[model samples]
Every structure is written in structure tokens, then in C-alpha cells.
Target: MNAERFEALAEAFGGDVARWPADEREAAAVLMAARADWARSVLGLAGEVDTALYAYAPPQASVGLADRIAAAGPRPGRGRWMGFLWPAGLGAGLAAACAAGIFVGAHLSAAAVSAEPLEPVTMAVSDQDFDFDLDGEV
Candidate 1:
């Protein structure tokens, strides 16, 4: 690798060439051996950077963070299990229900109409035919 790329890799992966990407490690080693003085300077800077980074202290999380998380409760699965009951699914379900209701209502209406007996198709039928003479007369 060129001096620039070797130096960049050393800076990125720290002073340890072994920790560098395996594909570039051999080339980086050859370049470093060729220019020992440059390699020493670059490695020294990388070591210093690593030391400073390792010494950093991160800020802790706010108080009651665990309690807040615990109180929130476990969330339900929002994966494929609930994919069927979507905006489109709701419409499909409603359409299916309406179709079923129409089928059942049609059957019920037909049954009701057929259940009651039809009146005889008589032209001269009169209420008096079934009435009794209140007086004792013919």
C-alpha cells in the first residue's frame, strides 16, 4: 500500500497492524518495513489517540430510567401476525360481513313469506258463508 493509505489504516485501526483488514495487512506491513521512521511516527500518533479515547468517561443515564422503562410495559408484536388486520383488511372484513348478512336476510325473508298459508283463490267467498244466523230463522 502507499504511505498515505498505510498511515490512514494505522490511524483507523490503531498502532496494531494485525488488527487491520486482512486483505490490506500484508501490504501495510511491507510499506511500514520499507519506511521504518515514518511507520514509528504514525504508530506513535495512533497510540496516543487510542490512549486518549480509552481514557474518556461517558455521561451516565438519567435517574429513574429503569423505572420508566418498566412502567411502559411490553409492546405487542407488530410483525406479520398483525399484517392481516390492516386498513385494507378492515374494508375486506366489512364487505364480507355485509355479504353474509344479505345472504342470511334473503333466506329468512323467503322463509317468512312461505311459512304463512295463502288465502284460497275464490271469487265468491263471503264472510256470511261462515257466520251463523243469530235469530232462530232460516
Candidate 2:
């Protein structure tokens, strides 16, 4: 490994060769063997940061923290009906729209009938359709 790569690995893995990636450990070892002094300097800097992080202690939460967080959560009744009614409301709205369309169609048909005069319907008969002779007998 190059000096730059060795320094980068030391910084990322907290100067611990064991913490370095398994594939990179061999290359890092080779680099350290070639440049012991330079590698130690980089590792020393990274080790200081690691030591500070390991020494840190976070503040503990109070006993009522969970209860307070739970109290801040959504109430049971909020949006409860929406889960059950969303699809049902969509179906009801579609049904209303269909009913409205049918009502408008019927109203339009009735208006058209009253506003225009009706015409007589006639049909033409072909000779092939009726070939029976009329001999004045039933």
C-alpha cells in the first residue's frame, strides 16, 4: 500500500490494525513495515481522536422520558375514521357521480322529446321476403 492509503486507513479505522478491513490489513502491514516512522505519526494522530471518543460518556435520560414521549404521540381517535372511511368514501363518491350522470341523461332525453316533433316510422318490404299468393281465401 502507498503512504497516502496507509494514512487514510489509520484515520478511518482509528489507528487499530485489527479494526482495518481484512483485505486492507495485509497491504497496511506492508506499508507500515516499509515506512515505520511516517506510519506511526499518522497512527498517533488518529489514536488521540480514538482515545477521546472512547472516553466519552453520554448523559442518561430521566425515568419519565418514555412516558413523556408516548404522551406526545398521536391520540387514538385522531385519523382513526379516515383509515376505515377513505375507500368507502371513494366508492360513495363514485356512486353519486354515476347517479348524477344518469339523472342528467334522462333529463336531456325528456327535454329533446318535448322540444321536437315525433316522426312516423316506415319499413320497405322486399318481394323475396313475402312470396305467398293472395287468392281471396284465408
Candidate 3:
């Protein structure tokens, strides 16, 4: 039943008591009855503001606005996969590398088979070769 609460309700909901919040409307009405003059002054100003807002006219959009917006949008086309092939030049490069590897491998293997066998070197091992002092301790 506060005057400030009554003023706020009247301003927001307009001069109609029914339009005010159901729970608060009764208390606000009591305040309005107790201070009719103040409540009327606040509600009168609120009504004036509401009237001016209602009287305003909104501007219309320009002609062909819908057409322009529609035209600017994306057009339907083939699926995403149709756009481009992935790793475009990698296939050709890979084929060329494989061919070069086969050629080199064949050439190396043929040369190895045709080359002269290395002569086996004969050496004598003795106990003196293993007589050095080891650096690590057990």
C-alpha cells in the first residue's frame, strides 16, 4: 500500500487497475484510495505517454527489399564432394616416386649380382687380443 509502489504500477500498467499485477493490484488500489490526488496525477501522465506512443506511425520498408535479400542468399548446387578433389597433385607425384624407386632397386640388385665376390680375409685370434684391462668395475 505504498504510494511509490502505486505510482510505479500505474505508470507501467496504465490507469487501469485490472491490468496491474493480480497480487499487488489490491494493495495499490488501497494506496490510490488513500491518496487519490497523487495517484491520479501519476496515472494521468502515464496515460498521456501511452497515448502518444500508440499514435506513432512506423516507417515502411523500401520496395523490392525482399527480392534483394533473396538474391544475396546462397544458391543450391551439387553436393560438397563435387567442389574439389583432395590432395590434387599428390597422386601423380606418388606414382612418379614409385616408378623411380623400382628402377633404382632393379639396377642396384642386378649390379650386386653381377659384381665380383669379395675375397675372404684370413686372421688368427690369440688370448693376448683379450688381455686389455676393462674400464668398468663389477
Best by lDDT: 2
TM-score of 3: 0.38
Please report how far candidate 3 places residue 130 from its true position, in Å: 99
Better of 1 and 2 by TM-score: 2
In order of appearance, the predictions have TM-scores of: 0.41, 0.42, 0.38
Q: Over the full model, what C-alpha lDDT does candidate 3 score relative to the true structure?
A: 0.75
State the lDDT of candidate 1 residue by residue for 1-138, as single tens digits.
898898888779998777789999888878878999989899888988888887998988799997898865544673553455553576887788899999999999899788996666767665565545778554
Estimate candidate 2's alpha-carbon lDDT, on a 0 to 1 scale: 0.83
Task: Estimate, for each residue in 1-138, the C-alpha lDDT of model 3 and write its tens digit.
Answer: 777777777778887777778999778778878888888888888788778887998987799998999975555672343223223565776687899999999999888778977578867775555444586532
Q: For model 3, what is the alpha-carbon lDDT of residue 74? A: 52
Q: Which portions of model 1 show Cα errors greater than 4 Å?
A: 18-22, 34-37, 70-138
The lDDT of each candidate is: 0.81, 0.83, 0.75
Q: Candidate 1 versus the native: TM-score?
A: 0.41
At residue 34, give the lDDT of candidate 3: 84
Give residue 91's lDDT in candidate 2 (0 to 100).
87
